[model samples]
Target chain A: GESVGLHLPTLSVQEGDNSIINCAYSNSASDYFIWYKQESGKGPQFIIDIRSNMDKRQGQRVTVLLNKTVKHLSLQIAATQPGDSAVYFCAEIRGNTGKLIFGQGTTLQVKP
Target chain B: GAGVSQTPSNKVTEKGKYVELRCDPISGHTALYWYRQSLGQGPEFLIYFQGTGAADDSGLPNDRFFAVRPEGSVSTLKIQRTERGDSAVYLCASSPARNNEQFFGPGTRLTVL
Candidate 1:
């Protein structure tokens, strides 16, 4: 989902439920994509990353899926917990420049 | 192990004042980058450095903003005649290679009053 202005698109899920956050990227040549979690007053922490070559990459409790055809990516969190609540962002890096372009973040609100 | 660290975790300055934000990237990381993140928005690229030279500064908003990586490890972002709009979280990141996973530092929250 996309956001505008001062508001971020929010997703509400129950604790222990699976959560999926979707991001539509703009760059067609982007070879690398990463998922980051940001809590209040803190910097972004890396969750997982997926290269364009693979369609799916799984971590401990997280999985990243990249659909290069439509330029879409998604992050799935298994057994979402209360501490999992935070702002999630998807960033991509182009080939020429190492600069990362970040997508509008999605706020995940895990309810107990 | 120490990750990237930034000085002046929080900075407040009057408009038109000059400010310098420092970032110490992880040792041996060759590529460093600067980004600005405003409230409710994702971080925007500001600059990138390769070694002691600026690899790309096209992301910089204007000439008033400049960054330097003096020894290819420590970097400082300088903003002259700062305006209220300059208030945002400036984040610095580093990577082992040009196209690798980047490690980010706790951003320097700059508030131009």
Candidate 2:
């Protein structure tokens, strides 16, 4: 199936530690990828995005690395905080209509 | 500026009933999308609208599910004869034309019994 999936279902990190969430996608034609953070009752919020042409992208305290070779993608959060405790999702956009497909979420538990 | 908004944050319904979910995108956004997220799973694409017309309905699971954006700003997702399998969070997102950064609203949680 041409699906995007996460390598881990849950990740636990200390307040000051870095956190990494991984994703694997099967579609080679996928050109764009994004990472989103979703709180308990809110919709997923865009954190960062990287084009397939680029291998990496960085945001305020987060970084997204894309490895087209292994069809893998990762989101790295520096100095994880209690506010970062949420379900993170990765998404891909391709084709003409410009639809965004999301991957299974990985819950991040940041302990203070 | 206000972000996207969805009406009736939560809905509880019985099988074989009908329900409607509404979405109001950020002002000036031209592209709108609908998605369904089940527990422990990601959001699945349901439909996409550009302007007042639906550009893609390929992701709709069945004919029972339908949506429309009449004025190109507000949209509605209608489900007929809802089934238990239809229980999930319905999400609405919108972007400015071809902009890839989609702003999503707090999804409407639908519970079917």
Model 2 stretches with alpha carbons more than 4 Å out = none
Docking class of 2: medium
Q: Score the docking of each candidate (DockQ).
A: 0.74, 0.80
* Model 1 Cα lDDT, one tens digit per residue, B1-113: 89999999999999999999999999999999999999998999999999999989989999999999989999999999999999999999999989878889999999999
- In model 1, the runs with Cα more than 4 Å from the true position are A1-8
Best by DockQ: 2
lDDT score, residue A7, model 2? 93
The alpha-carbon interface RMSD of model 1 comes to 0.9
| lDDT (10s digit) by residue, model 1, range A5-71 | 1124899999999999998866576788888999998888889988889999999989999888988
- Each candidate's B-chain TM-score, in sequence, is 0.99, 0.98
Model 2: per-residue Cα lDDT over A10-65, one tens digit each: 99999999999999999998889989999998999999999999999899999999
